[model samples]
Target chain A: MDQTILDTLHDVIVVGSGCTGAMAAQTLLESGMKVLMLDGGMMDSKYKSLIPDTSYTDFRQKADDQYKILIGENLEGLNWGEVSTGAQLTPPRKFITDQVEIFLPLESNNFHPMESLALGGLGGAWGLGSCIYSPPELEKAGLNANKMHEAYRVVSDRIGISASNDDASPYTSGGFNYFLPELEIDSNAKSLYDKYKKKRNDLNRDGFFMGKPALALLTEDKGERKKCSYNDMDFYSDKDKSAYRPWITIEEMKTKYKNSFIYLGEKLVKEFSEENNFTTVTCIDMMDNSVKTYSCIKLVLASGVLGTARIVMRSVKSENVKFPILTNPYCYIPCIQPGMLGKSADQRRSDFAQLSLFHDPDKTNADVAMASIYSYHSLMLFRIIREAPLNFKDGRKMMRWLLPAMTIMGIHLPQQASEGKYLKMMKDENSPTGDKLFAEYSLNEEEKLSRKIREKKFLHAMRKLNCFAIKKIDPGFGSSIHYAGTLPFNDNEAEFTLNPSGRLNKFKNIFVADGSGFKYLPAKGLTFSLMANAHNVAKTVIEDARK
Target chain B: MNFAEENKYNSEAQILSNYLVGTQVDKKSLELYSGISKTTNHSMNESDLKIWNFLMKHPGFISSIDGALAFTNPKSSVRKKIFFMFAILECRPELSAKFMSSNFTGFYWVKFIWYGVHAVFTTIFGLFLLQWIKRF
Candidate 1:
């Protein structure tokens, strides 16, 4: 058959069904462009049909393949000789454990890595804790807080977040006013707030009060999405409320833009055309191994941190690329006090409720940069301990008694290091997972110290909160789930960046909106930030095209 | 109704299954079938004992010699596993209902089922015991 060519190539093709991708697709389609979205994984209709009364778990009985954990599992020792060498080339199906070998080398070998492979990517399974990047994070990206806030307002409005705060400024101006009725703080949490609020005031530090952060969950009726019934379970299966998963927006985007199309369970993109002004994408469908091709005037790669980085390294065979890379290292601390934790898996409190710890550069010493602290739900805490195979046998017993365990994630922005810190693409023969992932990364002396110092601080905080037990992680026991930066956007680097509009500098049609274009170090979970960045990039692409 | 009360009112078939599970009446048979001398790890928890006792005292007693022999067979792993799990239900049916009916009921029930299945699948004799239990 002659190569098929249509009169209208899509204005843009958004790759990956992650939050960033969905946001880009929604924004672009709403702007009157022909958009096509291609998810590298399957579709999740559980939350998709929430308001419409469709249940995601109508028939699910156990934690089967679909409910697998959201992390990569190299399983080197577990899968030796059972599978062929090529199997390691792809991501694992189960939520990855720390035992799996990572592609990146460590500085002193410290980092806890976790990433997912489902259609919505990490956002699908992430603790639905939505905190807009503090002002410092915006400045790190070379953008002011106002611009970032504008983009967040746009995103928050579409997703229908339910939140309230005494101090939400200019960012929440547009979208903040309207949302589901403010979630009522439970009496116990309220009492804890009163107890801590006075003590926090005494410390004179910005004491965070217990209130629901503006979440993309519905409390009022919306199309096909029922308002939340206060069932505070945030992670895993959200059988009730429609929280901020990308698939929800994608459904709306698909309806608004009739020209838009989506393909799920499709194979990963194997090749793409970025030669002239147009880009052609080619892939081998995993379902049947059949080759499929998609062409668009512009292509956006949003396959997330590791996935996007790997794709770029494989697709662009050119060695002449200019951009600095940063790897984020994380630490977890659990705080438990008698009676602080109530029943197990009860729907008494929201899991994603906590304030983020961001580094105030102005207040910090010159040597150290700012950092962001995040909280995890009890269920996630249980999963983290369960991942350690050593305690797998007694996980149930531990679950019975352990009170509030708080996980503090400290994102250490890796400084530039030539020795092994820079993320480089490498193909290896003997990866334990039987596949070859782009391997490159090593922490520097500063990062190594940063890891220890932050872990210690978090540990001390836990102790102050009356925690009984504490455990520090050693090197090789860590890996970051949120991977960002291998492709930094600099106006000067034509060969590396997509120029001013987030397009590949050389290829006018190819663009990237995910974490790939970010250069900020110690990046907080950049999902919302990247969505804003995509909004700006999409606006630029359309405006420039008109010119 | 409570598992005990429910077991009393339950049909003879379900009662026998519950009693067999609650008392672990087939412990000797399971020990013989597995051929492994184990004490603590393989032994039934308190919950399992409750289920076995319920099964033995169930409304429909296994009166026939054949039925009795089948129930006592040590080789039936699936049947044994099911009875063992049912035994747990008998012990703490009230707590189980409480867990399942709570606000986050869906998540807890899902977790309860998952842990239960994981334990059952790990045992070598579980599948056979389940088959036997289902047959009766």
Candidate 2:
């Protein structure tokens, strides 16, 4: 509506307001550069109006009562009970876009990706599991360790990470500073920690190291954000703003640098091209159905891996261009610790996985696997029961008795780019977004073997802690919600590769700050690394602009 | 009750039950359920009627039925789903009995036995492990 905001050609145009885009904008704004962020999704205000300031129990009760009318029947076999934390349905904030087009090879079975076109992108519904890659892991992923360390510290300071230097330090490579106190471990998690402490030598020999997981959630009040209420509502609601969301940074940038930073919502960018030393981005404004063009001196593509890839593929006009994608192979194993059964469910605490188990059996190879521990109460029992081979009724009864004693371990295994696993873009005239993105991903034989070995080690560790792993369910691929490597950054520039600073090889002024530039994806959560990488790239952009 | 009235009530109850269980229902049934809620002023949508019928059939749910229906609302979709989930919770006893008594063929019987043995062994092992660790 403001003519002045659109009239001026911005110095930098950052697309997507996710973790990377927001961080990139923050760094550039601090350097006194005007930045305009364009997003396809708008924030939904209903979430705040509906469940404002309600306790965890009341929220759950309210949600359960209204779920039938709100969500209707589980038409797509989605267990509505698990809607809070599960990746089956798009959360309210991310309900703006339709499911991205995906075509899987017949041989590639059970790979379902969870993508979001929300204002903050996938970070809006993230688990807040934040972990930095170790030096060796970073090197294996084709990134410089020295630069990454500085970037990690800068990003960590901006978005608070709560973690302690514990036994897992050897595996996690503990050198970075944190902003908040570590969250308290639950009774079941505490038991596992004690067992790890007592049997440290044995577990170490077996390549299993356990400790408190670092989280993006705040434990103390910082700026406008309050401390975590420990209400176990991290999955469903963000009432407290304690758990860090990238939109918080975007909001801050809007207020602190109102004149310099501008956010254009509901604008789906189609493609971009460079002409006369200026980059021109063509986008469709979903609100008014208007095709608009914006030109900038520098353009940064942080619209996530799939989104950035789609834009690049469309711009390059190549259907045969194949970019390798790496996703963490994910599985959920439910373990029962009878001692923790029948505990009071009313206790308030952070429900996100409080502990992480890291295993690097063959330390020589860059193969790493992590298992995050979540209490049974955090998940809906019906979903777990539905996984059983028994009839629904029997499964429900079993779940009722077993849920109290159960703690789920979300296992993540490292995956690399393979011939069978890559993303392809196809031109679809019928698609409202102009292009359809097809991702074909399948675990190779070697990766499958590796997963079995890693899973065995996880189960063995659980047994040593006196907990039995009753059942293991692989929710298939892409459920890990960590997608990367469509346009990998390489030292030697290639057709689909970017330079170390995330500048696409062919285009000098175009840059990529999202997971699209990752060559290799480790088993750890990718949000923290994405933020650091974006911050690092912002510095390069600022330097380049000055020159 | 007259046969016509009894038939109408049964048909409405069936529609409500089917809708709650995720079965496709006609718009006529939806409108009928809405009309009934309006007349009775009970906040009883399709989901609530399903729950009410289940409660009447199984008196065992009487204890927790009030808590289940406390948040029922005809206008709110979220409240409707929650009410149905509560109904499922209250009817768990009957549901479990039905599952236990269901007929099974040869391979199904084998599967049932296998799961039964596995469940028993795990429960015993879990209890024993808990007590042993408690001693530490």
Would you estimate the TM-scores of all the predictions?
Answer: 0.65, 0.79
Worst 10 residues of 2 chain B by lDDT: B94-103
Best-performing candidate as measured by lDDT: 2
Task: Residues A194-247, candidate 2: write the lDDT tens digits.
Answer: 877988898878878888888898888888888888776565567678888888
lDDT tens digits by residue: candidate 1, B55-120: 455423222211232334422232333333232222232222211222333364466456445443
Sum up the clashes in candidate 1: 66
Of the candidates shown, which would achieve the greatest TM-score relative to the real structure? 2
C-alpha positional error of residue A237 in candidate 1 after TM-score superposition, expressed in Å: 2.4
Task: Encode model 1's per-residue lDDT on A387-490: one tens digit a residue.
Answer: 22221222332334332333333333333323453444444555321233434455667767876665555444334434433444332322435555566666
Residue A176 local lDDT, model 2 = 53
What fraction of the correct interface contacts does each predicted structure contain? 0.00, 0.00
- Model 2 misplaced stretches (Cα beyond 4 Å): A1-6, A58-110, A362-366, A389-398, B1-136
